[model samples]
Target: MSVLRPHGSAFSGRLGWGRAPAVVVVDLVRAYTDRDGPFGLPDPEPAVAATQLLVDAARADGHPVVWTVVRYAPGLADAGLFVHKVPALACFGEDAPGHWGELTLKPGAGEPVVVKQYASAFFGTTLASTLHGLGVDTLVVAGVSTSGCVRATATDALNYGFRPQVVRQACADRTPALHDSNLADLDAKYADVVDLPEALAHL
Candidate 1:
């Protein structure tokens, strides 16, 4: 196999030119990131750390920082076909303590949390309006399941007229291959895939 080059070089010189940017943490909740939770993948601690760094930078720069969690009402009626397709999600019902993660924002950090039911935070949520209200034109995205919620959120961010920046190291999937493949696809078609250090440099 050819040596895989870092994604940072791909967006060199195109980094920090947006009007106002925000960091969007999509579905980094316990149900997906915690090892003991039902739909949890492997340890997502590293991804969480990377996301924390981005969150810190965004808050320091006075940029909006939004956190998204997937919440479903009891009985799974609110989850629709998603729960049926992936029965694991049913564990994140409204009353379930496993619905959210241990990593949460500090009080009065940046912005309010956007609770969502779908993979994309922009779908059926106040995320767009929140960003718009914050005057955010660029979106720096981080979260769990690089191939699922992260990808979906990035794609929808692009569609919503926000420049989506997918933090390569701040996202994870069940496997490394899926994470790498989805990052490549997002870089090619949806958003700019960048590493944590490079992203910080841009900011």
Candidate 2:
């Protein structure tokens, strides 16, 4: 804890917004938003509403909007070791009891939806190349389970040389502790943990 005083000391440099920025809505799906679903968050509406704000802002600004959702073949055939790690991931399987794989924030016309089998949207997916092709240098990421997919995406965004801006209000986790801690870590290292207004202003 003593060492935590100087946060981001090594990673303090900000990778500010670039010439082209895009909004990436990740895993805003039923499994997390629907209260009865297996991976549901206690209160997901706030994040959903906040995410919608970013989406609207991006559209109004004529910025690209990309989406990511977890989908697996029946029996988790494509999930690999992730299923072994978090068995709750079964909710995203094709055989899940409900329509958990459905996107809560539906993609607008022509908005590409990246179907992922794991945490990081870029892992084993074409997100990097897609962003490269679209000329997106900054990714405004919003989604659920801040400690998991959100953090993973942000970290990978940096590894792949993209500035990642994570909106606080647009991300939810199983608990406040997890959300806050992960956001702090991301802001100190991987991404900028921003608020809705600040993110909207830049859009």
Candidate 3:
């Protein structure tokens, strides 16, 4: 009898880039990049730098580039249970001081920005319809908090019938452990966790 290796040993199938691909930058805002902010990651520069490369490549390739930012109504009224669970999310409040919600990696003119209050960019957003209208079948996802928004967006992209390619170098988390673990799980099941060059070539 053959012995099984591990949880992800048999799940190594790859979903190469499809006919139409879009680069999705998820929640790469000052809230997480600003070192002094409540939800800031320790070392977010590398991820930000890597994501910028993906954005540039997508723009040069004439592919769609979608951006997501976390925003909530005044007094956290629109945050629902999410704010309750993570009180630090108040950094995204409309009145949050100093524009904590601003995107660190600026989007190009006319790029679509999706405002989301949840981890998954598709939740309560028009991202799916927009992608459909643009004829985008594959999504190259890059952004902050690999264990949170990035993972959520990539998984939802796959659930919504879009091939999801998560760029490993373009994602950050509170710690390297969290970042690596989530990427492993995502690559094993939800999306193809690809390198920056692989994603850029695909774009």
Candidate 4:
């Protein structure tokens, strides 16, 4: 879609942007971005490419650009039950090969990269504190698997008192139905479901 307009959207109002807005790119790693990888979905290239624009805009706007990745310790000791539900998460193990844990976006020098063991970036990570220090009040979210990590992070961003905005073009899921449905759910209650242009304007 070229705009922020969502068809048949049940949502009423836009939370819009707050005083300080930050961008959070979730799990855009080889395990999710790589087509041949175990956890890989179809092609997320368009989503990844679209996200760079928002990322650059956020950086230029002087807003914090945070990246979240799933990395587990040896023997998957820290993963809890999530690992068992999705055994493919082993691809992000500390002892996993370098290529398996590769990041699609090479974070800039000062960009904060939050390593998470669970779906939400706020879970078992310093994302909240990092955002606190950066004085972030709104979060522009983008990343792989809209129904998974992206959804989890956006939900937590709202629960943590930050206005969350999910860019439709910058987030992907394995199927179109899953992507559209989740975005609808988020727009109805959790966050604002926007397009690339809308996200940029907020930044």
Ranking by TM-score: 3, 2, 4, 1
Q: Please give the range of 10 consecutive residues that has the lowest summed lDDT in model 1.
A: 101-110
Per-residue CA lDDT of model 4 for 1-203, tens digit only, reads 57776666655578888889999999998877888887777878899898899999988888889998888899889989998999888888898775677789889889988999999999888999889888999999999789999999999999999999999999999998999999999988899999898888877
Q: Candidate 2: which stretches are off by over 4 Å?
A: 1-8
Return the TM-score for each candidate structure: 0.86, 0.94, 0.94, 0.92
- Per-residue lDDT tens digits of candidate 1, residues 32-138? 66677675778688888898898888778877788887778877679988888887777667776553543443424436788778889899988888888878888
Best by TM-score: 3
Clashes of each: 0, 0, 0, 0
Reference-based lDDT, each prediction: 0.80, 0.92, 0.92, 0.89
Which 10 consecutive positions of candidate 4 have the poorest summed lDDT?
3-12
Per-residue lDDT for 91-198 in model 2, tens only? 888887788889998799999999999899999999999999999999999997899999999999999999999999999999999999999999987898888998
Could you tell me which residue pairs clash in candidate 1?
Answer: none
Residue pairs in steric clash, candidate 2? none
TM-score of 1: 0.86
Stretches of model 1 off by over 4 angstroms after superposition:
1-17, 97-110
> Judged by lDDT, which candidate is best?
3
TM-score of 4: 0.92
Better of 3 and 4 by lDDT: 3
